[model samples]
Target: MIACGEKRLSQKRKRPNILFAIADDQSFPYSSAYGTSGINTPAFDKVANAGVLFNQAFVAAPQCSPSRAAILTGRNIWELEEAGTHGSYFPKKFTVFTDLLEDVGFEIGYTGKPWGPGDYSKAGWTRNPVGPEFNRKKLTEVPADGIHKTDYFGNFVEFYNQKGNDDPFFFWFGCHEPHRVYEDGSGLKSGKLLTEVDVPDFLPDNKLIQSDIADYAVEIEWFDQHLGKMISFLEEQGELENTIIVVTADNGMPFPAAKANLMEYGTHVPLAICWPAKFKGKRITDDLVSLIDLAPTFLEIAEVENVPQMTGESLKDILFSDSQSKINAVREFVLTGRERHTHARPDNLGYPSRAIRTSDYLYVKNFKPERWPAGDPVPESAKQIIPAEGFKELWPGYQDIDPSPSKMHLLHEKDSLSRYFKLAFDKRPMEQLYDIKKDPACINNIANDSTYATIKKELRDLLESELKKQGDPRVLGFGEIFDSYPRTSKMREFKGFNKRGKYNPKFTQKDQQIIE
Candidate 1:
């Protein structure tokens, strides 16, 4: 007795609802689901147990703005122009997957952080690129320090209430957890013992560092808690079976040599996806997946076409298939890179670098080896004379690395802990190579050693070939254009860099054609 239009609407409603939950600045192997002991992530574990847990998920860029941009557009970071760089304007020409979904009659909304630390308003968009906002709710008391007090669960309830009964909704649950400025000893206060934390080989083993990691674990737990609530809400609404839930992070944890660097911990992120109606559950795949793959995957799942510009491959087949061996064989490697992360360098220049990670080895090409890898060697506070201690002088300009207890310990004990400090803050060679299986921390570089010469060349050639195919400006000899792009963020003054506020004259409007 229903009308034809009503029947079509009902058919659309049968399509899956997408609930994408992203944690800010969380790395892989931090969740209990991954056997990382310090943190208990019941929500992440539930998704993994109920669906597919991707062991090798990576972000296109190590920094937030660019990484989120790549995930939204399904393209390489360099192809995005201003959006490719950190804290820059989002050019309106590049289409975001959310806008495409919205145009196709999908009711999309997001709570908390959504695609920015940058200016999207300049692109003429009325709201965040993710979708319309639903973050008016507030929490009376947050569970821990360094956690945003946004009532994410309450906001999701409000979002669901506003949804039409027949609408297939796409909701972005972006949690601003595990970023920075943690309350010292908050994790220990929460009953998490320091002994439970596993310190990476790159960092010195000390109580301060352990406690800092514990605090980071606490924030991740906060994100997981919100995820649990949202999942419960979906189940209560009877939308759990048909809904596709993806749990992941924007980038790695905020720490020295992790967040901004192109190391393993920097780009590698945790991922779990579930949809009971379409895919088999309780599967684990070691397929190499880039966050960019999610945009195309979502579009395909929704059956919305017209994504010719998307360079990322859709993982729909892999997700829906019950064959674990077949899914793992699809992707062999993943590419990740970075441009401007922060205005830490002279003239706000970024440490432009490209990297390729295969099953066994990781190869990195630092385009500007002359520049300091972390940041400038001088501290922002020290204007005139360089401090007598080399470590003290470098403290202010190591802004590329986040300030943390680990970094502080390394700096304070630099007299005896010089090796650790050098591993994190020193300058580097043009080419770097590491056997990630043996050296996951990426502390040892064997690019020049004759033993790894073959692997170094092979990885370098593969990385260059892929970059050229993608038309990356960095590989196309206009890499300086990335440095030339106008940064919309607040500019900081660095000594000897007179062009702090000015764009590079070498770059011209015609240079943008390279990206097109």
Candidate 2:
């Protein structure tokens, strides 16, 4: 807790461990490191204070499945075929870095979520997606209460203390927090008094929104605190010095704009790395980094050679050296995309959007621009019933929702608020470009503007070149690429997170409807 003093020299360095801590629904807004929000995250603060915090860190996709898929594999989401979007379907052919690392003598293990929305066992995989289970305590600890799962952190320590000492670890500490359906007002419990939670100016500044943000901050803190404890554990175990500690979110915060969209709030994540043995490069780097590069980063650091085909560059050079004068940044831009989320909306729709995010702007070319961006509108049958409100089914648990009064108010107004919140969740913009510096919210698109024509064209070109390099199906035609790829049973099944069937996945079962 004392002001970070200079780290004096240590004795012989051991091959460092890699501690990858990923949080769910986390946005770049809160981390004190970003200096944007007023939310206090001392744990993340400590990491940023000690290490290099990437201001423009992004995942390959907005939603969890593809994002995680990209991280596990060193390729872009599209290159992985059916794993193109969340829980869509991932072909079993792709090779994951976890399996690769394990093959190379590193002990890999994880708890909590792994490559999701698909059948893990059927994927031709031997162990759990993360390899060797880490959540044993949860089998008995998590109550019969179907609403919750076991605490991932508690189970991790129990597993690691027993299994990790033998070899260097590539442990993935995944936290499913701040994601959804938390106990309201949970953030208020941990001495985090949110008299004022810094919220984005785009959202309505009512207590409802602020309280929503406060609850989110609390969950983020919960994840951060657990990670802080884990860090303490590492320090106790003498692994802190060499371990590459990366604290980040899978994608962005799960608000209207963040989770599913390719906007800054969605793809722009908070990444801070603290590797005591790496380097003392104290300043923040604006060089763009994608989660896809994670495999190469790990491979480079561990000195593994001739890995699978990779589009990602290693951060080894960036992390270990002081080449501030070099022109070789990670990449000029990072590409992001999505295959599906909710089911197709009214026109029986589905969305397939592709975008390229740069340091200055975000250019997205919506392939299915004609379809609703937010799946189809709520089912026509549900249209008669008024929309339900009160945080829309998925409210945070940290808030002090005096349900008696609050529920009454929410019940009567749920319909209106539901419809209100539904706006952002509804549609599409064809060719969109936002100057992140000026409009961080991505509310405005200057794609058609004459003055910004050159910037747009440049960005557009960058996107096309990158997509072509990555071999996106969209270039050959969305339907053609998708049809050519042939989705597996899992990716074909659409029953999105929204189970109402409003946007039921337009899934064509493997044998039932062959694309050829």
Best by lDDT: 1
Off by over 4 Å in 2: 1-14, 36-38, 138-149, 164-166, 188-195, 323-330, 344-349, 386-423, 478-516
lDDT by residue for model 1 (152-256), tens? 999988998988878889999999898887888999999998988978888877898899999999999999999999999888889999999999999998887
Best-fitting candidate, scored by TM-score: 1
Q: Give per-candidate clash totals.
A: 1, 22
Per-residue error (Å), model 1, residue 115: 0.9
Instruction: List ranges where model 1 is wrong by over 4 Å.
Output: 325-330, 379-395, 496-502, 506-516
- Judge candidate 1 against the unseen true structure and give its global Cα lDDT, from 0 to 1: 0.84
Error of 1 at 501 (Å): 8.2
lDDT of 2 by residue, 392-448 (tens): 222221111112222233434556666434335545567888888898887777888
> Lowest lDDT 10-mer window, candidate 2?
396-405
RMSD for each of the candidates: 3.0, 7.6
